[model samples]
Target: MLIALLLAVATVPAGQMFACTPIRVWDGDGPVWCREGPRIRLGGIAAREIDGSCRRGQPCPRASGIAARDALVRLLGGARGRSGTGHILVTGPRLQCRSTGNAKGDRTGAWCSAPRIGDLSCAMIATGTVLRWQRYAAGHCR
Candidate 1:
Protein backbone atom coordinates (compact mmCIF):
# COMPACT_ATOMS: atom_id res chain seq x y z
CA MET A 1 0.00 0.00 0.00
CA LEU A 2 2.81 2.38 0.86
CA ILE A 3 4.56 1.64 -2.39
CA ALA A 4 1.34 2.20 -4.29
CA LEU A 5 0.83 5.50 -2.54
CA LEU A 6 4.34 6.63 -3.35
CA LEU A 7 3.94 5.81 -7.02
CA ALA A 8 0.85 8.00 -7.31
CA VAL A 9 2.82 11.22 -7.13
CA ALA A 10 2.85 13.13 -10.44
CA THR A 11 6.18 14.25 -11.85
CA VAL A 12 7.45 16.61 -14.49
CA PRO A 13 6.84 15.87 -18.16
CA ALA A 14 9.42 14.60 -20.66
CA GLY A 15 11.46 17.82 -20.90
CA GLN A 16 9.96 20.38 -18.52
CA MET A 17 10.89 20.66 -14.81
CA PHE A 18 10.65 22.90 -11.76
CA ALA A 19 12.75 23.49 -8.68
CA CYS A 20 11.45 22.58 -5.20
CA THR A 21 12.68 25.56 -3.29
CA PRO A 22 12.41 26.54 0.38
CA ILE A 23 8.91 25.55 1.56
CA ARG A 24 7.44 27.99 4.04
CA VAL A 25 5.80 25.88 6.72
CA TRP A 26 2.26 26.91 7.62
CA ASP A 27 1.28 27.70 11.22
CA GLY A 28 -1.17 24.82 11.52
CA ASP A 29 -0.85 21.16 10.54
CA GLY A 30 0.18 22.17 7.05
CA PRO A 31 3.86 22.46 6.08
CA VAL A 32 2.61 25.60 4.40
CA TRP A 33 2.94 24.65 0.72
CA CYS A 34 5.64 23.97 -1.83
CA ARG A 35 6.73 26.54 -4.35
CA GLU A 36 7.37 26.68 -8.17
CA GLY A 37 5.15 23.63 -8.75
CA PRO A 38 2.63 21.06 -7.60
CA ARG A 39 1.01 21.51 -4.15
CA ILE A 40 0.67 18.45 -1.88
CA ARG A 41 -0.70 17.45 1.50
CA LEU A 42 1.16 15.29 4.03
CA GLY A 43 -1.44 12.53 3.55
CA GLY A 44 -3.11 10.59 6.41
CA ILE A 45 -2.14 12.82 9.34
CA ALA A 46 -3.18 16.32 10.20
CA ALA A 47 -1.17 18.66 12.41
CA ARG A 48 -2.39 19.91 15.78
CA GLU A 49 -3.83 23.38 15.88
CA ILE A 50 -1.16 26.04 16.41
CA ASP A 51 -2.83 26.76 19.76
CA GLY A 52 -4.09 23.23 20.24
CA SER A 53 -2.83 21.42 23.28
CA CYS A 54 -1.50 17.88 23.57
CA ARG A 55 -3.50 14.92 24.91
CA ARG A 56 -5.90 16.23 27.48
CA GLY A 57 -5.06 13.93 30.40
CA GLN A 58 -1.31 14.44 30.37
CA PRO A 59 0.64 17.59 31.10
CA CYS A 60 1.55 18.74 27.60
CA PRO A 61 4.30 21.21 26.73
CA ARG A 62 3.73 24.95 26.76
CA ALA A 63 3.77 25.13 22.99
CA SER A 64 3.37 21.66 21.55
CA GLY A 65 2.16 23.04 18.25
CA ILE A 66 5.31 25.08 17.90
CA ALA A 67 7.32 21.98 18.65
CA ALA A 68 5.55 20.06 15.90
CA ARG A 69 6.16 22.93 13.51
CA ASP A 70 9.82 23.02 14.46
CA ALA A 71 10.10 19.28 14.06
CA LEU A 72 8.62 19.56 10.57
CA VAL A 73 11.05 22.34 9.69
CA ARG A 74 14.00 20.28 10.86
CA LEU A 75 12.82 17.26 8.92
CA LEU A 76 12.42 19.16 5.65
CA GLY A 77 15.53 21.22 6.28
CA GLY A 78 17.69 18.14 6.57
CA ALA A 79 16.32 16.80 3.30
CA ARG A 80 16.67 20.12 1.52
CA GLY A 81 20.25 20.57 2.71
CA ARG A 82 21.24 17.07 1.58
CA SER A 83 20.50 18.02 -2.01
CA GLY A 84 23.01 20.36 -3.65
CA THR A 85 21.66 20.43 -7.18
CA GLY A 86 18.28 20.91 -8.88
CA HIS A 87 14.79 20.27 -7.38
CA ILE A 88 14.29 17.74 -4.56
CA LEU A 89 11.01 16.32 -5.88
CA VAL A 90 9.78 15.63 -2.37
CA THR A 91 7.08 13.06 -3.08
CA GLY A 92 3.45 13.66 -2.11
CA PRO A 93 -0.15 12.75 -2.94
CA ARG A 94 -0.97 13.80 -6.47
CA LEU A 95 -4.67 13.16 -5.75
CA GLN A 96 -7.14 15.48 -3.98
CA CYS A 97 -4.50 18.16 -3.39
CA ARG A 98 -5.74 21.62 -4.23
CA SER A 99 -4.32 22.98 -7.47
CA THR A 100 -3.64 26.17 -5.50
CA GLY A 101 -3.36 27.11 -1.80
CA ASN A 102 -6.47 28.36 0.07
CA ALA A 103 -5.45 27.97 3.69
CA LYS A 104 -7.46 30.61 5.55
CA GLY A 105 -11.01 30.02 4.32
CA ASP A 106 -11.80 26.66 2.76
CA ARG A 107 -8.62 24.93 3.99
CA THR A 108 -8.05 22.93 0.81
CA GLY A 109 -4.49 21.71 0.29
CA ALA A 110 -2.41 18.54 -0.04
CA TRP A 111 0.49 17.15 2.02
CA CYS A 112 4.04 16.41 0.78
CA SER A 113 7.65 15.60 1.74
CA ALA A 114 11.27 14.93 0.67
CA PRO A 115 12.56 11.95 -1.33
CA ARG A 116 13.36 8.68 0.52
CA ILE A 117 12.73 10.55 3.79
CA GLY A 118 9.01 9.81 3.62
CA ASP A 119 5.97 12.04 4.09
CA LEU A 120 5.69 14.81 6.71
CA SER A 121 2.45 13.32 8.09
CA CYS A 122 4.30 10.10 8.88
CA ALA A 123 7.13 11.95 10.56
CA MET A 124 4.65 13.87 12.69
CA ILE A 125 2.90 10.64 13.61
CA ALA A 126 6.22 9.09 14.67
CA THR A 127 6.46 11.98 17.10
CA GLY A 128 3.72 10.13 19.05
CA THR A 129 1.59 13.18 19.59
CA VAL A 130 -0.03 13.19 16.16
CA LEU A 131 -2.11 10.50 14.51
CA ARG A 132 -3.62 9.99 11.07
CA TRP A 133 -6.66 12.06 10.40
CA GLN A 134 -9.94 10.13 10.44
CA ARG A 135 -11.17 11.72 7.26
CA TYR A 136 -8.39 10.25 5.08
CA ALA A 137 -7.58 6.94 6.79
CA ALA A 138 -9.24 3.55 6.86
CA GLY A 139 -8.82 2.65 10.53
CA HIS A 140 -6.60 4.82 12.80
CA CYS A 141 -3.01 4.06 12.04
CA ARG A 142 -2.11 3.30 8.44
Candidate 2:
Protein backbone atom coordinates (compact mmCIF):
# COMPACT_ATOMS: atom_id res chain seq x y z
CA MET A 1 0.00 0.00 0.00
CA LEU A 2 2.95 2.31 0.64
CA ILE A 3 3.96 2.17 -2.99
CA ALA A 4 0.42 2.83 -4.08
CA LEU A 5 0.09 5.81 -1.75
CA LEU A 6 3.41 7.18 -2.93
CA LEU A 7 2.34 6.92 -6.53
CA ALA A 8 -0.97 8.59 -5.83
CA VAL A 9 0.69 11.51 -4.06
CA ALA A 10 3.62 11.89 -6.37
CA THR A 11 4.28 15.57 -7.20
CA VAL A 12 4.48 14.58 -10.86
CA PRO A 13 2.14 12.12 -12.53
CA ALA A 14 3.32 8.53 -12.11
CA GLY A 15 3.84 7.98 -15.84
CA GLN A 16 5.85 11.22 -16.19
CA MET A 17 7.75 10.86 -12.94
CA PHE A 18 9.04 7.51 -14.09
CA ALA A 19 8.77 7.63 -17.88
CA CYS A 20 9.45 11.17 -19.26
CA THR A 21 12.79 10.30 -20.72
CA PRO A 22 14.58 12.65 -23.15
CA ILE A 23 14.13 10.83 -26.40
CA ARG A 24 14.46 14.21 -28.17
CA VAL A 25 15.30 17.86 -27.33
CA TRP A 26 15.02 21.40 -28.74
CA ASP A 27 16.45 24.92 -28.20
CA GLY A 28 14.29 26.64 -25.64
CA ASP A 29 15.80 28.63 -22.85
CA GLY A 30 15.13 25.23 -21.36
CA PRO A 31 13.94 22.49 -23.69
CA VAL A 32 11.22 19.90 -22.95
CA TRP A 33 10.97 16.54 -24.63
CA CYS A 34 7.81 14.65 -25.65
CA ARG A 35 6.54 11.54 -23.97
CA GLU A 36 2.85 11.04 -23.25
CA GLY A 37 2.37 14.69 -22.21
CA PRO A 38 3.49 18.34 -22.27
CA ARG A 39 5.93 19.17 -19.51
CA ILE A 40 9.09 21.33 -19.31
CA ARG A 41 7.62 24.34 -21.14
CA LEU A 42 4.93 24.50 -18.50
CA GLY A 43 7.29 24.23 -15.52
CA GLY A 44 10.86 24.98 -16.54
CA ILE A 45 12.47 28.43 -16.60
CA ALA A 46 13.26 29.64 -20.10
CA ALA A 47 17.02 29.52 -20.49
CA ARG A 48 17.36 31.56 -23.70
CA GLU A 49 15.23 32.30 -26.71
CA ILE A 50 16.30 30.04 -29.52
CA ASP A 51 14.74 32.45 -31.98
CA GLY A 52 16.89 35.38 -30.90
CA SER A 53 20.25 35.82 -32.49
CA CYS A 54 23.37 37.38 -30.97
CA ARG A 55 24.24 39.40 -34.06
CA ARG A 56 22.19 41.10 -36.76
CA GLY A 57 23.35 40.55 -40.29
CA GLN A 58 21.39 39.60 -43.38
CA PRO A 59 19.56 36.66 -41.87
CA CYS A 60 22.08 36.65 -39.09
CA PRO A 61 20.70 34.70 -36.20
CA ARG A 62 23.02 34.38 -33.26
CA ALA A 63 24.64 31.01 -33.52
CA SER A 64 24.64 31.00 -29.75
CA GLY A 65 21.18 29.48 -29.47
CA ILE A 66 22.06 26.47 -31.57
CA ALA A 67 25.25 26.11 -29.59
CA ALA A 68 23.18 26.27 -26.45
CA ARG A 69 20.84 23.52 -27.61
CA ASP A 70 23.71 21.34 -28.66
CA ALA A 71 25.25 21.90 -25.27
CA LEU A 72 21.97 21.03 -23.61
CA VAL A 73 21.78 17.74 -25.49
CA ARG A 74 25.35 16.97 -24.58
CA LEU A 75 24.80 17.85 -20.94
CA LEU A 76 21.55 15.92 -20.73
CA GLY A 77 23.01 12.95 -22.51
CA GLY A 78 26.04 12.93 -20.27
CA ALA A 79 23.77 12.98 -17.23
CA ARG A 80 21.01 10.78 -18.67
CA GLY A 81 22.03 8.35 -15.89
CA ARG A 82 20.24 5.04 -16.09
CA SER A 83 17.13 4.33 -18.14
CA GLY A 84 13.95 6.38 -17.78
CA THR A 85 15.63 9.14 -15.72
CA GLY A 86 17.68 12.36 -15.81
CA HIS A 87 14.88 14.89 -15.78
CA ILE A 88 16.39 18.38 -15.34
CA LEU A 89 15.30 20.26 -12.23
CA VAL A 90 14.41 23.93 -12.99
CA THR A 91 13.81 25.12 -9.42
CA GLY A 92 14.36 28.88 -9.70
CA PRO A 93 11.20 30.11 -11.35
CA ARG A 94 7.66 28.82 -11.32
CA LEU A 95 6.12 31.38 -13.69
CA GLN A 96 3.94 30.72 -16.73
CA CYS A 97 5.48 30.84 -20.19
CA ARG A 98 3.82 32.20 -23.32
CA SER A 99 1.50 29.86 -25.19
CA THR A 100 3.46 29.17 -28.32
CA GLY A 101 2.94 25.98 -30.32
CA ASN A 102 6.38 24.52 -30.45
CA ALA A 103 6.88 21.39 -32.52
CA LYS A 104 5.22 19.89 -29.47
CA GLY A 105 2.29 21.62 -27.84
CA ASP A 106 2.69 23.53 -24.56
CA ARG A 107 2.49 21.72 -21.20
CA THR A 108 3.80 21.39 -17.64
CA GLY A 109 6.99 19.54 -16.69
CA ALA A 110 9.53 18.73 -13.93
CA TRP A 111 13.27 19.46 -13.89
CA CYS A 112 15.96 17.20 -12.44
CA SER A 113 19.64 16.39 -12.75
CA ALA A 114 21.27 13.62 -14.73
CA PRO A 115 22.11 10.96 -12.16
CA ARG A 116 25.36 12.08 -10.48
CA ILE A 117 25.92 14.68 -13.24
CA GLY A 118 24.39 17.87 -11.76
CA ASP A 119 21.89 20.47 -13.00
CA LEU A 120 21.50 20.77 -16.79
CA SER A 121 20.84 24.53 -16.90
CA CYS A 122 23.68 25.41 -14.57
CA ALA A 123 26.02 23.21 -16.54
CA MET A 124 24.99 24.82 -19.84
CA ILE A 125 25.36 28.35 -18.52
CA ALA A 126 28.68 27.57 -16.87
CA THR A 127 29.99 26.19 -20.14
CA GLY A 128 29.01 29.46 -21.94
CA THR A 129 26.44 27.82 -24.17
CA VAL A 130 23.69 29.76 -22.43
CA LEU A 131 23.37 33.00 -20.46
CA ARG A 132 20.83 34.31 -18.00
CA TRP A 133 17.74 35.77 -19.63
CA GLN A 134 16.54 38.56 -17.32
CA ARG A 135 13.08 39.27 -18.76
CA TYR A 136 11.13 36.63 -16.86
CA ALA A 137 11.81 36.64 -13.12
CA ALA A 138 14.00 38.01 -10.33
CA GLY A 139 16.35 35.15 -9.58
CA HIS A 140 19.46 33.32 -10.86
CA CYS A 141 18.56 33.87 -14.53
CA ARG A 142 16.74 37.04 -13.70
Candidate 3:
Protein backbone atom coordinates (compact mmCIF):
# COMPACT_ATOMS: atom_id res chain seq x y z
CA MET A 1 0.00 0.00 0.00
CA LEU A 2 1.24 3.49 0.87
CA ILE A 3 4.16 2.14 2.88
CA ALA A 4 5.32 -0.04 0.03
CA LEU A 5 5.23 2.96 -2.26
CA LEU A 6 7.28 5.00 0.18
CA LEU A 7 9.84 2.26 0.57
CA ALA A 8 10.18 1.91 -3.18
CA VAL A 9 11.12 5.56 -3.60
CA ALA A 10 13.26 5.77 -0.46
CA THR A 11 16.65 5.78 -2.14
CA VAL A 12 17.83 9.36 -2.01
CA PRO A 13 21.40 9.72 -3.23
CA ALA A 14 24.32 10.89 -1.14
CA GLY A 15 25.07 14.62 -0.81
CA GLN A 16 21.49 15.65 -1.52
CA MET A 17 19.22 17.80 0.57
CA PHE A 18 15.77 16.47 1.24
CA ALA A 19 12.62 17.22 3.17
CA CYS A 20 11.39 14.89 5.85
CA THR A 21 8.31 15.14 8.00
CA PRO A 22 8.83 12.33 10.43
CA ILE A 23 5.78 10.22 11.13
CA ARG A 24 7.20 7.05 12.60
CA VAL A 25 10.32 5.93 14.44
CA TRP A 26 11.73 2.46 14.67
CA ASP A 27 14.26 2.62 17.49
CA GLY A 28 16.76 5.37 18.30
CA ASP A 29 19.04 5.44 15.29
CA GLY A 30 16.09 5.09 13.12
CA PRO A 31 14.24 3.98 10.17
CA VAL A 32 12.28 7.16 10.73
CA TRP A 33 9.55 7.15 8.15
CA CYS A 34 9.01 10.56 6.60
CA ARG A 35 5.83 11.74 4.99
CA GLU A 36 7.67 12.73 1.85
CA GLY A 37 8.83 9.20 1.08
CA PRO A 38 12.18 8.63 2.75
CA ARG A 39 13.29 6.41 5.57
CA ILE A 40 16.16 8.09 7.44
CA ARG A 41 18.71 6.68 9.79
CA LEU A 42 20.11 9.45 11.91
CA GLY A 43 23.73 9.83 10.97
CA GLY A 44 26.70 10.04 13.37
CA ILE A 45 25.17 7.96 16.12
CA ALA A 46 24.27 4.48 17.20
CA ALA A 47 21.88 3.05 19.78
CA ARG A 48 20.91 -0.34 20.99
CA GLU A 49 18.79 -2.39 18.67
CA ILE A 50 15.17 -2.94 19.67
CA ASP A 51 16.06 -6.25 21.24
CA GLY A 52 18.44 -4.41 23.57
CA SER A 53 21.44 -5.87 21.82
CA CYS A 54 24.29 -4.05 20.19
CA ARG A 55 25.64 -5.60 17.06
CA ARG A 56 29.26 -6.65 17.13
CA GLY A 57 31.66 -3.77 16.51
CA GLN A 58 28.96 -1.11 16.94
CA PRO A 59 29.12 1.42 19.71
CA CYS A 60 27.27 0.16 22.73
CA PRO A 61 25.71 2.84 24.81
CA ARG A 62 24.90 2.42 28.50
CA ALA A 63 21.21 2.65 27.82
CA SER A 64 18.57 0.14 26.97
CA GLY A 65 16.95 0.06 23.58
CA ILE A 66 13.69 1.33 25.01
CA ALA A 67 15.44 4.23 26.66
CA ALA A 68 17.08 5.26 23.42
CA ARG A 69 13.91 4.88 21.42
CA ASP A 70 11.91 6.91 23.89
CA ALA A 71 14.52 9.65 23.86
CA LEU A 72 14.32 9.87 20.10
CA VAL A 73 10.52 9.91 20.23
CA ARG A 74 10.64 12.84 22.62
CA LEU A 75 13.08 14.77 20.48
CA LEU A 76 10.84 14.31 17.48
CA GLY A 77 8.01 16.30 19.09
CA GLY A 78 7.03 13.54 21.50
CA ALA A 79 5.10 10.42 20.77
CA ARG A 80 1.62 10.90 19.51
CA GLY A 81 1.17 7.20 19.97
CA ARG A 82 2.90 3.84 19.70
CA SER A 83 2.29 0.35 18.40
CA GLY A 84 3.11 -3.14 19.62
CA THR A 85 5.03 -3.70 16.45
CA GLY A 86 7.87 -1.34 17.45
CA HIS A 87 6.59 1.63 15.45
CA ILE A 88 6.38 4.89 17.35
CA LEU A 89 4.00 7.45 15.96
CA VAL A 90 5.48 10.94 16.30
CA THR A 91 4.58 14.56 15.69
CA GLY A 92 7.96 16.09 14.86
CA PRO A 93 8.63 19.21 12.85
CA ARG A 94 9.68 19.00 9.25
CA LEU A 95 13.41 18.40 8.87
CA GLN A 96 16.02 19.32 6.31
CA CYS A 97 18.76 16.75 5.91
CA ARG A 98 21.89 16.07 3.93
CA SER A 99 22.19 12.49 2.89
CA THR A 100 25.41 10.60 3.51
CA GLY A 101 24.20 7.81 1.31
CA ASN A 102 22.56 4.44 1.83
CA ALA A 103 22.61 3.11 5.44
CA LYS A 104 22.08 -0.52 4.70
CA GLY A 105 18.82 -2.09 3.63
CA ASP A 106 16.35 0.68 2.77
CA ARG A 107 17.46 3.60 4.91
CA THR A 108 19.37 6.72 4.00
CA GLY A 109 21.86 7.89 6.60
CA ALA A 110 21.52 11.61 7.10
CA TRP A 111 22.11 14.35 9.59
CA CYS A 112 18.76 16.02 10.16
CA SER A 113 17.99 19.37 11.68
CA ALA A 114 14.90 21.39 12.35
CA PRO A 115 14.58 25.03 13.44
CA ARG A 116 14.31 24.57 17.21
CA ILE A 117 15.69 21.09 17.59
CA GLY A 118 19.04 21.55 15.91
CA ASP A 119 20.91 18.47 14.70
CA LEU A 120 19.19 15.24 15.59
CA SER A 121 22.40 13.25 15.80
CA CYS A 122 23.84 15.63 18.38
CA ALA A 123 20.58 15.84 20.21
CA MET A 124 20.35 12.08 20.45
CA ILE A 125 23.83 11.89 21.87
CA ALA A 126 23.01 14.58 24.40
CA THR A 127 20.26 12.40 25.76
CA GLY A 128 22.91 9.78 26.53
CA THR A 129 20.68 7.16 25.07
CA VAL A 130 22.94 6.74 22.09
CA LEU A 131 26.61 7.14 21.40
CA ARG A 132 28.64 8.76 18.67
CA TRP A 133 29.26 6.19 15.99
CA GLN A 134 32.55 7.38 14.60
CA ARG A 135 32.34 5.25 11.51
CA TYR A 136 29.42 7.23 10.16
CA ALA A 137 30.05 10.49 11.96
CA ALA A 138 31.97 12.07 9.07
CA GLY A 139 32.75 15.05 11.30
CA HIS A 140 29.10 15.93 11.82
CA CYS A 141 28.36 14.68 15.36
CA ARG A 142 29.17 17.77 17.26
Candidate 4:
Protein backbone atom coordinates (compact mmCIF):
# COMPACT_ATOMS: atom_id res chain seq x y z
CA MET A 1 0.00 0.00 0.00
CA LEU A 2 2.86 2.37 0.72
CA ILE A 3 4.36 1.78 -2.73
CA ALA A 4 1.00 2.36 -4.38
CA LEU A 5 0.57 5.63 -2.51
CA LEU A 6 4.02 6.77 -3.59
CA LEU A 7 3.23 6.00 -7.20
CA ALA A 8 -0.03 7.92 -6.96
CA VAL A 9 1.75 10.92 -5.58
CA ALA A 10 4.35 10.78 -8.35
CA THR A 11 1.61 10.87 -10.98
CA VAL A 12 -0.35 13.67 -9.35
CA PRO A 13 2.03 16.36 -10.61
CA ALA A 14 1.85 14.97 -14.12
CA GLY A 15 -1.90 15.35 -14.04
CA GLN A 16 -1.51 19.03 -13.21
CA MET A 17 0.66 19.60 -16.24
CA PHE A 18 -1.17 21.06 -19.25
CA ALA A 19 0.01 20.66 -22.83
CA CYS A 20 -0.92 22.47 -26.02
CA THR A 21 -3.54 20.83 -28.20
CA PRO A 22 -4.15 21.22 -31.91
CA ILE A 23 -7.36 23.13 -32.64
CA ARG A 24 -9.10 23.76 -35.95
CA VAL A 25 -10.91 26.98 -36.91
CA TRP A 26 -13.63 26.81 -39.52
CA ASP A 27 -15.31 29.81 -41.08
CA GLY A 28 -18.73 30.05 -39.44
CA ASP A 29 -20.66 30.46 -42.67
CA GLY A 30 -18.68 28.00 -44.83
CA PRO A 31 -15.84 25.48 -45.10
CA VAL A 32 -13.17 28.17 -45.56
CA TRP A 33 -10.16 27.95 -43.25
CA CYS A 34 -8.36 30.92 -41.63
CA ARG A 35 -4.61 31.24 -42.37
CA GLU A 36 -1.56 32.42 -40.43
CA GLY A 37 1.74 33.94 -41.55
CA PRO A 38 3.74 37.22 -41.81
CA ARG A 39 1.13 39.22 -43.74
CA ILE A 40 -2.38 37.93 -43.10
CA ARG A 41 -5.49 38.94 -44.95
CA LEU A 42 -9.04 37.66 -44.96
CA GLY A 43 -10.60 36.87 -48.30
CA GLY A 44 -7.97 39.12 -49.86
CA ILE A 45 -9.23 41.85 -47.59
CA ALA A 46 -6.95 43.98 -45.39
CA ALA A 47 -7.54 44.14 -41.62
CA ARG A 48 -7.36 47.94 -41.36
CA GLU A 49 -11.13 48.42 -41.48
CA ILE A 50 -11.87 45.71 -38.86
CA ASP A 51 -13.23 46.86 -35.49
CA GLY A 52 -14.03 45.27 -32.12
CA SER A 53 -12.68 44.61 -28.65
CA CYS A 54 -9.96 42.09 -27.72
CA ARG A 55 -11.38 41.26 -24.34
CA ARG A 56 -11.57 37.68 -23.25
CA GLY A 57 -14.84 35.89 -24.14
CA GLN A 58 -15.93 38.81 -26.33
CA PRO A 59 -16.37 37.83 -29.97
CA CYS A 60 -13.88 39.86 -32.03
CA PRO A 61 -16.07 41.96 -34.32
CA ARG A 62 -15.28 43.66 -37.66
CA ALA A 63 -16.74 46.44 -39.76
CA SER A 64 -17.49 43.95 -42.46
CA GLY A 65 -19.05 40.60 -41.61
CA ILE A 66 -15.60 39.01 -41.85
CA ALA A 67 -14.29 40.36 -38.54
CA ALA A 68 -13.55 36.97 -37.07
CA ARG A 69 -11.47 35.96 -40.06
CA ASP A 70 -9.55 39.21 -40.21
CA ALA A 71 -8.92 39.25 -36.48
CA LEU A 72 -7.49 35.75 -36.55
CA VAL A 73 -5.31 36.64 -39.50
CA ARG A 74 -3.90 39.77 -37.87
CA LEU A 75 -3.23 38.22 -34.49
CA LEU A 76 -1.41 35.19 -35.92
CA GLY A 77 -0.05 36.98 -38.99
CA GLY A 78 -1.77 35.09 -41.80
CA ALA A 79 -4.67 35.24 -44.22
CA ARG A 80 -8.22 33.93 -44.05
CA GLY A 81 -8.72 31.38 -46.76
CA ARG A 82 -11.23 28.71 -47.67
CA SER A 83 -8.72 25.94 -46.89
CA GLY A 84 -5.97 27.65 -44.91
CA THR A 85 -5.62 26.45 -41.33
CA GLY A 86 -3.03 26.53 -38.55
CA HIS A 87 -2.81 25.58 -34.89
CA ILE A 88 -1.64 27.47 -31.78
CA LEU A 89 -1.23 24.87 -29.07
CA VAL A 90 -1.07 26.75 -25.77
CA THR A 91 1.14 25.50 -22.94
CA GLY A 92 2.12 26.27 -19.31
CA PRO A 93 -0.01 28.67 -17.24
CA ARG A 94 -1.63 29.68 -20.53
CA LEU A 95 -3.48 26.39 -20.53
CA GLN A 96 -6.28 28.30 -18.85
CA CYS A 97 -7.31 29.72 -22.23
CA ARG A 98 -9.99 28.08 -24.40
CA SER A 99 -11.69 28.47 -27.79
CA THR A 100 -15.22 29.92 -27.99
CA GLY A 101 -18.05 30.69 -30.41
CA ASN A 102 -20.55 33.52 -30.61
CA ALA A 103 -24.26 33.02 -30.11
CA LYS A 104 -26.40 33.80 -33.10
CA GLY A 105 -27.18 37.56 -33.42
CA ASP A 106 -24.57 38.60 -30.85
CA ARG A 107 -21.38 39.96 -32.43
CA THR A 108 -19.34 39.53 -29.24
CA GLY A 109 -20.38 35.89 -29.12
CA ALA A 110 -18.54 34.90 -32.31
CA TRP A 111 -16.37 31.81 -32.20
CA CYS A 112 -12.70 32.07 -31.19
CA SER A 113 -10.56 29.51 -32.98
CA ALA A 114 -7.84 29.93 -30.33
CA PRO A 115 -8.46 31.66 -27.03
CA ARG A 116 -5.91 32.88 -24.47
CA ILE A 117 -5.74 31.03 -21.16
CA GLY A 118 -8.68 30.06 -18.91
CA ASP A 119 -11.54 31.44 -20.98
CA LEU A 120 -14.53 29.28 -22.01
CA SER A 121 -17.39 29.79 -24.40
CA CYS A 122 -21.16 29.72 -23.93
CA ALA A 123 -23.98 31.99 -25.09
CA MET A 124 -21.76 34.64 -23.42
CA ILE A 125 -18.11 35.16 -22.52
CA ALA A 126 -17.01 33.72 -19.18
CA THR A 127 -15.16 35.50 -16.42
CA GLY A 128 -11.41 35.16 -15.85
CA THR A 129 -8.55 35.56 -18.32
CA VAL A 130 -9.57 36.73 -21.79
CA LEU A 131 -8.05 35.67 -25.18
CA ARG A 132 -6.99 37.70 -28.16
CA TRP A 133 -7.03 36.45 -31.76
CA GLN A 134 -4.00 34.23 -32.39
CA ARG A 135 -3.81 31.67 -35.23
CA TYR A 136 -5.50 30.73 -38.50
CA ALA A 137 -6.06 28.22 -41.33
CA ALA A 138 -6.05 28.61 -45.11
CA GLY A 139 -9.08 29.15 -47.43
CA HIS A 140 -11.34 31.79 -48.95
CA CYS A 141 -13.92 33.56 -46.85
CA ARG A 142 -17.61 32.96 -47.48
In terms of TM-score, the best-performing candidate is: 3
lDDT of 4 by residue, 6-73 (tens): 23331212112222221222231211221110111111122222233333543343334244433332
lDDT of candidate 3 over 6-99, digit per residue (tens): 4566567889888899999999999898888899999989999989999999999999988999999999999998868869999789999988
Error of 4 at 33 (Å): 9.0
The lDDT, on a scale of 0 to 1, for candidate 4 is 0.25
Residue 137 in model 2: shift from native, Å?
A: 6.7
Candidate 2, residues 24-58, lDDT tens digits: the string is: 45563444543423345422234444555542322
Give TM per candidate: 0.49, 0.47, 0.91, 0.23
User: How would you order the candidates by TM-score, starting with the best?
Assistant: 3, 1, 2, 4
Give the poorly placed runs of model 1, Cα more than 4 Å off.
Answer: 1-22, 37-41, 53-63, 78-108, 138-141
Give the 10-residue window scoring lowest on summed lDDT in candidate 3. 1-10
Model 1 deviation from native, Cα RMSD in Å: 10.2
How many times do residue backbones clash in model 2?
Answer: 11
Q: Give the deviation of candidate 4 from the true structure as CA RMSD.
A: 15.3
Which residue ranges in model 3 land beyond 4 Å of their true spot? 1-8
